[model samples]
Target: MKTLYLDAFSGASGDMFIGALLDLGVDIAQLRTELQKLPVHGYTLTADRVAKSAIYGTSFDVVLDHGEKDHGFIEHHHAHGAGDHQAHHGRHLHEIVDLITASDLSATVKRHAIAIFNDIGAAESRVHNVPLAEVHFHEVGALDSIVDIVGSCICLDLLHVDRVKCSTIADGSGFIEVAHGKMPVPVPAVAQMLSDRAIPVQQHPEVHTELLTPTGLGIIKEFVTEFGPLDAQSAVQQVGYGFGKRETGQFNALRAMILTTSQSQKQTAVGHDQVTLLETNLDDQTAEGLSFAQEQLLAAGALDVYFTPIQMKKNRPGVQLSVLVPPVDRDRFVTLMLKDTTAKGVRYTTFERTVMQRRFETVTYQGLPIRLKVATYQDIRRVTPEFEDCKVAAQKLDVSLETVMAAATALAR
Candidate 1:
């Protein structure tokens, strides 16, 4: 198993992330070839060594050709009237999408890049009250942003990590200026992008400035799977620094760590597991209501949800609702269950389970084909239905949910 750990001690920015990856040895030539796919009239990728506090590091820069508007705009945008005027060479979200689709990159790479942009666009849209397509990306729509995004995707592809995990961002306090003008720290756009992801900004004396920008926030918002304190035992293969422009009392840099693990562990084989299983029994709820609650819990990011028939005290009938969630999400998920269910108290346990490599095969039940994911840990095979597919099949065939799930489970074996 392989993993990438992001340490946003100094915070993250679009360019800093790209520079760190480039410094980490991703092929710049290949990245440039892909960037050319965007329909920008003219542009060039430049990589060079830059110094931060006497530490020489690689800095990635984008030089774009503005054609006629180059003169006035360059003069207007530059700090002083030294260079030619520059054009608003910034691109629209649609243009970025077109560039991504037109690039001759692998399908996986393209999908990843597109998904990243979608995440950013969704955030910008939500904040501005505009449609995603109509949203004009501010800092992230620029040439540098496009390069950062495409380049980050390429770097991830090169590393070929199975999963990416992040730690709670140490987003510093204070306000920062942007295209929309100066706003509160951790700008609204960034807040919206991280609506679902957990990146708590803790107060640290050594930290200041808006360390996490919307672009960088959007990247993690879409790709990260889990968030918490870094596990000290995780094996680290390499560590790279993504530097931001802020200088706080503490060293500021986004630490990117590549993890080393066996291939089987990457998928589902678990050598050691410590997971929280939350359970509650309710006898007064209908099967349909339990089903709806389960759906909502999973959608809220619970790892798994299930129901078990049980005989309560005095032989009372009840359904035990169990939800498995990552430690970070436990509080939120538990609150959701409490609000949605009639259970007065929920019981939880931390247990260990050995996991193994398991594969699933497509099977047909009642003329509907379904795919099942089989997870094996310590020779115990746990099979589960592809519920979304089962739901679809049940609706199409006009069959009960149980009938579809049973058929799908049987075929999976």
Candidate 2:
């Protein structure tokens, strides 16, 4: 499996993440062309090699155009000085969603960008005690930050990263200024987002300034699937450093790398990873309640949730609720299981499982697009058509579902 690991020893920001991807060999011109699909304007993207404390890396910046001839609107806005920039560029969540949804960019890119913005918006909404729709994105909604968020997603797509892993994030202490006045390090929104997701964070008191920005946290929260040290057995394909603007009296950069782990390395079928299994026995809960709890657990990010019939004490029929979740999310899921269900206690165990390498391909059947999930293990491969796509094609072609699925499966094979 191919994985992208981010070593945020210093910290991360939207610009820093993009710079790292660019340094890792994402084509700058292609990224620019892809970003042009968005309706946003009044900015120019620039990237250059920069050094921080003897460490060299790429520094990407989105310079808002204030030239009289090129951007009369931005020039007029700039004439009011930095104080009014927020008022001029600040956008609500729905507005940003509309902008991304209307773009001609690839669906994957659009989904990623909007998800990041939605997370940030949710954090901001919680912090300010405002409705999610009424939450205004002042700094993140600016032209540069928008480019940073969306541009980072575009680069990841360009790289075809299968999974993202991050190290323990290092954030600083003290206060930083925001449009809402001075806020403590990590800020309210960043803190809220991290805590809500239970993302691991570390504080570096030596550097009394904010290291992690809200945009950075949003990006990490949206894409990163795992958090821990890099695997020692994996092979490192390439490494890139993304320089930050901070002067921390030490190297201030985010290290990103591409890593590959093959089946032969671990003598496994394809790949192996650890997961947390949570189980609870329930006999007092209603069917309606159990169904609702299952829905809630799935929505809360549980990898899998199912109920199995089992006999319990008192000679009564009962069900065993099992949930699969990432290790980092064990506590969060445990809390949800306890709260959303009638179980008095939940048991969890860590299990190592091997999984097949999976990839997706789209095929046209009867003029309708059907997606195939291809999984590989050693020299063996399995192809399965996506059920939803097959169902749609069957309805559109006035054919049976099984026929559409079989045809799609054969085509994929």
RMSD of each: 15.9, 14.5
Q: State the lDDT of candidate 2 residue by residue for 1-413, as single tens digits.
A: 57799999988998899999999999999999999999999988889987766777899888878622111111112234566544577677788889999999999899989999888777777777767765556555767778889999999999876579999999999887665567898888888887767788999999888899888998999899889998664679999998888777678888999997643233223478899999999999999999999877765556789999999988999999999987988987898899899999999999999888776678989889998888887898988888889988888889999999889889885
* lDDT score at residue 50, model 2, on the 0-100 scale: 77
| Tens digits of per-residue lDDT for model 1, 164-191 | 7887777777665555466776777777
- Model 2 clashing residue pairs (backbone): none
How many clashes does each candidate structure show, in the order listed? 15, 0
The reply for model 2, stretches above 4 Å from the true place, is 67-83, 267-413
**lDDT winner among the candidates?**
2
Give candidate 1's root-mean-square deviation (CA, Å).
Answer: 15.9
The list of candidate 1 runs beyond 4 A from truth reads: 50-56, 66-88, 203-208, 246-250, 262-413
lDDT of each: 0.69, 0.83
Summing lDDT over every window of 10 consecutive residues in candidate 2, give the lowest-scoring window: 68-77
